[model samples]
Target: MRVAVAEDGALFRQGLVLLLEAAGHEVVACEAGGDPLVAQLSTIPADVALLDIRMPPEPDGGLVTAERLRDAHPDMGLLFLSHYAESHYLMRILEIGTDRIGYRLKEKVGSVDVLSDTLTRIADGEIVIEPELAKRLVERPRSEKRDLVASLSERERDVLKLMAEGRSNNGIASTLFVSAKAVEKHVANIFDKLGLHADTSAHHRRVQAVLTYLRSQRGDA
Candidate 1:
């Protein structure tokens, strides 16, 4: 895949470029800040653009750039890399829209496999959230008044977690050592328990289920 990178740290940016190259992906454009990336976007035909959650020009400059990219190219895939997976950042990412988007920890994404997989998933129009961040969100305390996630069985919750990681039913089945039919059942149960019965595409419903699960647990950490 063709990739563009925007990061302030020189060494980290170079290292990321090397990692992308090692993973057999092309780094079409590399910039030290979000502005530069935005300026060069017209010329760079990147399948996926990787941005640092925190960068120069401003603290949330990367997010600012992402907003511009969304306005200019709504369908472009965006993958945000952060040293820490803060809930606030995830919320902001969600606000920017969940389609063809991703948020991953820098340390975890350093692995060639992880980086490549994330880009591929984003390019395929999946919401690729960091697994660690998903775990942290699930572990957050639930409120008694509106706890849809609490209605799910343990196995269903497991399925939901993998869904947040952007895994397909087959992938979840393989991970949980269950048949694909069982995984499908669990996913259906999760959607039902979450009250996602509106007429919509399966992909839209899946995204809604994940958003509901995460928002239900979003609170003071």
Candidate 2:
């Protein structure tokens, strides 16, 4: 795969280039800041753009760049690297749609395999949010947020939370230590309760379920 990267820290930027290149992906372009990345986008062709969500111009510079990239080149794949997986960041990412995008904590970059997998997954059109961000979105104080999400049982909510985290059934199963069959049943129940019967694509339904779960928990806050 071809990749472009934009990170303000020189050491991290160089390390990233090494990692991607060593993993058999070409690093076609590397920039020290978001603005430079945008300026070079027309000239750089890449399958995925790995970006840091905070940088020189603003704390949210990478996100701004990602949004601009989405507008300027809708087909571009995006994977964000952040110090913290805050809900606000994820919200903006989801606004770009739950496909061909991902969010991973900066700490995860230390693991070459995970970082490579995240980029590959995003390039292949998947919503891959880090676990911490998914937890926040799914486990917000239910006492205040329950009304809208009350239809789901506690276990069902657990399953849906992992689902929203972009986990496949097996992934959710491993996280919750439940059988894949049980996870499948929970997903079916979630779909029925949340009215995700719009189409046959489980991927689409999972995205819709996740959006519903996040929106409900984030209601008017």
CA deviation > 4 Å runs, candidate 2: 144-158, 170-182, 194-201
Candidate 2 local lDDT, residue 147:
56
Top TM-score prediction, candidate number:
1
lDDT of 2 by residue, 33-76 (tens): 88888888887778888899888568778888888888888888
Candidate 1 regions exceeding 4 Å error are 145-148, 219-221
The alpha-carbon deviation from the true structure for residue 43 of candidate 2, after best TM-score superposition, in angstroms, is 2.1
**Each model's C-alpha lDDT?**
0.84, 0.81
After superposition of all CA atoms, the RMSD between model 1 and the true structure is 2.2
